[model samples]
Target: MGEKLNISPGELRASAHAADTITKDLGRPLSKALEDIAAAADSLRHWSVGPQLKATGEGWGSALGKLRGRVGEHADGLRMVAAGHDVNEENVLNRFKGW
Candidate 1:
């Protein structure tokens, strides 16, 4: 006998929703922080360390952008999985109805 795999589409969707919320939550604050860093870097451009600071800030911004994109992709994958499971379940039920 094969082991049963119980899948919950609702749970998957909820998790995806949570991930989306997290992405949104991080985006607002981090974006503001980056803007502040950029402004500070501009203000201190004459100082020797100003360019370094700006470069570091840009690096962080790029990394964060990649992270955000990955998280969004994860959320999309979760939704896709949930929908696939839902369709599979529906097809199974329809087969049983014929019996």
Candidate 2:
């Protein structure tokens, strides 16, 4: 007779719990520049590319207002993404019991 393999249900339960906790903890939108870009998505899409370019050149006097600038911060985030690093900040309050 061949021996049967058995997997512990407790191990699977623990893994599922850990994944759920991490998902909730990592789901936060925490960048002022990102927030601004998201806020302008609708207006940005409505304007044609050339018009948007010319409007931007016209300075902040245009109806679209000033173009948001977060070049350095956005670049840093891009680098982190390129490096395969998770950009989300870990939730300090969500650590295993006693944390």
Write down the TM-score of every candidate.
0.88, 0.30
Worst 10 residues of 2 by lDDT: 61-70
| Lowest-sum lDDT 10-residue window in model 1 | 1-10
Clashes of each: 0, 0
Q: Per-residue CA lDDT of candidate 2, range 1-99, in tens?
A: 333533234444444455455444433432333445545654566667645644444443332222222333344444544334222223433454484
Per-residue accuracy of model 1 over 1-99 as CA lDDT, tens digit each? 233555589988998999899888999888999999999999999998889889999999999989998888899999999999989999999989957
Among the numbered candidates, top TM-score falls to: 1
What lDDT, from 0 to 1, does candidate 2 have?
0.42
Positional deviation of 1 in candidate 2, in angstroms? 14
Candidate 1: lDDT of 80?
Answer: 100
lDDT of each: 0.91, 0.42
Number of the top-ranking candidate, with lDDT as the measure: 1
In the order shown, the candidates' Cα RMSDs to the true structure are 2.5, 17.6
